[model samples]
Target: MGIIRKTFYTTVLTGASVFGYLGSTTTLISPLPQDDPFWRSRSFARYNVHHNACTQDICVKRIPLDKIRPELLQKEGDLVLEFCRGVWGGLGYKPQRAYLARKYQGPATASQLWTSEQLSKSTYERGTQITDHFEVVEKTPTDIVVRCGDTPRNPNPRDSDGLFVISAEVDKQRNEAVLALKSCFFNSGRKVEGIQGPTPGWMEEAHRWYTRLWMATGAWRVTR
Candidate 1:
């Protein structure tokens, strides 16, 4: 039984190490206060009624705008859009997009499909489709809100249909731009039951890891 105990302890240590590493690069905000600016933004206003019923996750990192390339600030929306593209370009998101494409018969080239020129010119207009599952719902110079998941075209939609937001706002108080990634899920209008139940703990943890990695990669891309 000594060998069994050793193996058990080893497994626990390894898991803890992995979790610690993942947590190191992440900054998450849960149970966002109702008064948070995000809730008052135009993007959120579109879905304000559903806020209380939604399952939301937010991850944030601040970027010192004064330190980054100055040309990126030439245009009003340039910084936020570049940051959004960076998040989508993250290595960790590639596999997730691939899996979704294969499982849902979505476009095969959904990952990194946007050219630099195309992204630079994009205004993120409402109803614009960003990928097979992601569509623009609202946007401004600082924030872009997207609706993702099964649509009315799908004979059946999953409970995961929801909103994904990427926002970069200059905070005068901190003298930095706050880059945030948020995911919110309520009921899939296409699904009669709405969100069936709470997400599994393992799934939530995995999602947190993915979000952190993606956010970190995006920050690196913008700052580097």
Candidate 2:
């Protein structure tokens, strides 16, 4: 089915009427337009400098394993995130802080323990470290959240032990197809994750969608 043709939601969106079972009326509540939690929680920069010297625009990119000078790692104290792709979470984004404590067989003070009870045994084994660390953004100690990063559901090619950013992955992973889809929605004063459009996926797409909406509806537009 075409993307637009695809219903906003499944079953839940479609009301039912049989045996007096009034079409499911359980309303789905997301966040608001102006305060998208996901975007707030996970947002990074992709840098590309095009130097046009009236001659030609040359892109200065740092590539790895290509006669490169040095390999850099993103480190902050006990936290160490390896950068495979030349790009790492730049300055714009901050680490998530909505940490979830793992039910450990070891010490409880162990902050970043991967909860095998929450995740899987293999996932726990592969874990060199675990974290419940996250960032709290907004009023009322409650804000945009990033949960359970000290472990993974499964340490396969996709799942890694580190901060999980939906935006960066969506764009960097491949062509910005999914990201474009998200750009279709994003309303002003819509209260971040409002009970409206925009589903979960990668971050770039999420921001693209948000930025698009912010632009279209003039969310950030200066009105006289």
| Candidate topping lDDT | 1
List of clashing residue pairs for candidate 1: none
Tell me the spans in candidate 1 whose CA falls farther than 4 Å from its real position.
1-22, 40-52, 103-123, 151-159, 188-197
What are the lDDT scores of the predictions, listed in order? 0.66, 0.23
Candidate 2 structure quality by residue, lDDT tens digits, 1-224:
66656664444355323212211211112222345343343321110011111100111111222221222112221011111110112211212211233233245435443333322221122232343332211111111112222233332211111122211111224322111111112222113333433333465344433333222221101111
Q: What is the TM-score of candidate 2?
A: 0.20
Per-residue alpha-carbon lDDT of candidate 1 for residues 1-224, written as tens digits (9 for 90 to 100)? 99999999999999788668657756787656677776676655554343335566899887787865666667787777777777765665667656654555445434323443444355566666543667777788988888765542442334556668888777778777788888776554432444333456677667777788778767765674
RMSD of 1: 5.2
RMSD of 2: 21.4
Measured by TM-score, the strongest candidate is: 1
Backbone clashes in candidate 2 total 31
